[model samples]
Target: MRVLIWILLILALAIGVSLLVGNNEGYVLIVRPPYRLELSLNLLLILVVLAFASLHLLLRFIHYARDLPANVRAYKENRRIRLGHASLLEALHALSQGRYQIAQKSASKALDLGEDPSLTALIAARASHKLKQKGQRDYYLAEAERLAPDAEVARLLLQAELLLDDRLYSQALDVLQQIEKIEHRFIPALRLELKVQLRLNNWEQVLVLLQQLEKHDGMESWQAREIRLQAHQHLIERHGHNLNTLMNYWKRVPAEDKLNTRIAKLAADAFIRLNAGNQAQEVLEMSLTREWDSELAAKLGDCASTNPQKQLQQAEHWLLSHEQDAKLLLALGKMCMRLELWGKAQSYLEASISVQPCAEAHLTLARLLDNRGETDAANRHYRLSVQACEDNK
Candidate 1:
């Protein structure tokens, strides 16, 4: 279409020029100092048109020649980038399928092909690590760091992993700490830092890091609980005398979280360690009110009091509510015998055995009956304890 338009335009211009030339009745002359030249109007017009067209074509050729090198370089770079992309994708797929050797090969090829060498280096390092090629892993990691020095996150993460692999907890911690400083609140870095701290028995830092992790919606509740247990264990070891500090720690935890069976159980143990028998009793009582766990119920019975009568009475009350809880029944029976309530102890102990016959319950009953001088029944229970123990074995 465009060619046809150009042809039509040229024809119209030619006809216009022809009419102008034909209508011309006079000519013009050009003169120098001592010479003169004269030509037809058509000849001068043709010369001017040829000069303009030749000049335009020459300028266009100059421009095209100037851009050729840059366009070729761009094309080569683009091809290299595409090859790198393909190599990276292949490596990732291989890694997912557990083909560590193949993944390593592809990642290396990507780096060699002049792809984003830094990224390829990182991938190669990971693949090498999985393949257990320690030398290659270290070399690739070093290259990645050299290629992208400002990528502190990737460098520290790799270093942290290496230190962890070597069981160098302190070194890993140092690297992770530096990463945290460089990139505050980085979840991946913080997670590694948390694990290193745990290995170093640094519970205080574990608590703080866990709170930061909780801010990330990706963290699971179970993971948080595990961290809490570690933190609690550490606090108990370090601050056993400071009830106020421990209480404040508990207060900072969400109320619903405190209600977790694991946390509740931990809290009960903590209270018992503190020798706050009354508080432990209260906490366990409240816990048992909602959950009839045999383990918690047993612990609750033990935490009731030093006074055997009071302990026995509390256990019995719990038993009324949780009659099916054999552990609670055993605890109550054991306390009754401690208080010398022989008949009641026997009844409770026998009931525990009936509900869930175990060595523990049988042994308790045997001891209780022996204490009351009921020789025949005590002998029978002793035999039952031995039988139960053997069965479990």
Candidate 2:
């Protein structure tokens, strides 16, 4: 178009100059000494202008002709991009409508147009997955991964989710680990990593993840503490068969923690297993001191009265506070009987039966009375003891 315009312009100039020259009588010019040339100046001017204009127009036309293929290619690329954009929009709409087949078709068509190859690969992969085309889905995913080595988080997350859904826990962990290696402490990746660790029973890894979560206040304090406690308990139980490790671990646990009723109970059992009744007694005493637990109090009293006079004193001190509880009363009664304090034993046994009647208490009192030569009262109490067990049942 520019070439045609230039040519027209040159033609108009040529015609104007020719008319001016034809209307003029020829103009003469003088030359250097001993030489003169006669010429029509206006006609000479027109010829020179026409020659330059022709050369310029010829060069322009040659350049434009040389660029024709490139222009055609550019036009085709632009048209393809527009089509791809339209196809992508249609694919997205179809996907939203749950038309998996149509979405796959449109996405493929979009990829065939001039869309970004990496983006095209992802859309095609997702669409194929939705359509249950496993082979095609894997191929597209592989292609996308190759094209964009720096994979998108959303795509990686989806892949991990799929692996998890299939119960491919190790594979899912591998993916999450890769993401962590690339972008350490990425929140979603770390969360998925923790979940994978939990699924695999990698308790050590879970503890570390829990610590990280705690730093961000991501988990409630009690929740984190509960998980840690569970992990610690598991670790302890795992090594419980090894006496040295179990003893060492138990000793290293903080004294305050040992006062927890559950911990105290477990520790007491462990101590009994190790034949360290004294340590068990100490744990029970500490636990009872913190809170009045009938269970711990009873265990403490039992342990104290098991062996010697010193532990008896400990049982007596505990009983001073819990004497009203029937279980504690029974414990005290048995301890006094073991010590041969028959009178004190009878007092406690009677007190226990009075507060909360139990077959054991009635029988213990009856036996004390019988041994003391009160046979008639002993027989009465014995019969009442038999009836008590049956009535409670």
Please report, in order, the local distance difference test score of every candidate based on alpha carbons: 0.79, 0.76
Best by TM-score: 1
List candidate 1 stretches off by more than 4 Å: 1-62, 94-114, 131-136, 201-205, 227-286, 300-304
Q: After superposition, how far is residue 261 of candidate 2 from its true place, in Å?
A: 3.1
lDDT of 1 by residue, 288-361 (tens): 67776788777754564666566666667766778888888887876676577778878887888889999988
Candidate 2 lDDT over 1-393, as tens digits, reads 999999999999989977886898876686987899777877567778999999999999999899989999999989999999988888889888888788778878887785665666677777787776879877867766766666666557666766675678989988877777777777777777777877787777777888788787776788777776776566667656666777787776757567788777776666656666677677787887888787665554345324656766776777777777887787678778777888888888888888888887788889888988999999999999999988989
RMSD of each: 5.9, 10.1
TM-scores of all predicted structures? 0.69, 0.53
Clashes of each: 0, 0
The weakest ten consecutive residues by lDDT in model 1 span 300-309
* Native-to-model Cα distance after best TM-score fit, residue 332 in candidate 1, in Å: 1.9
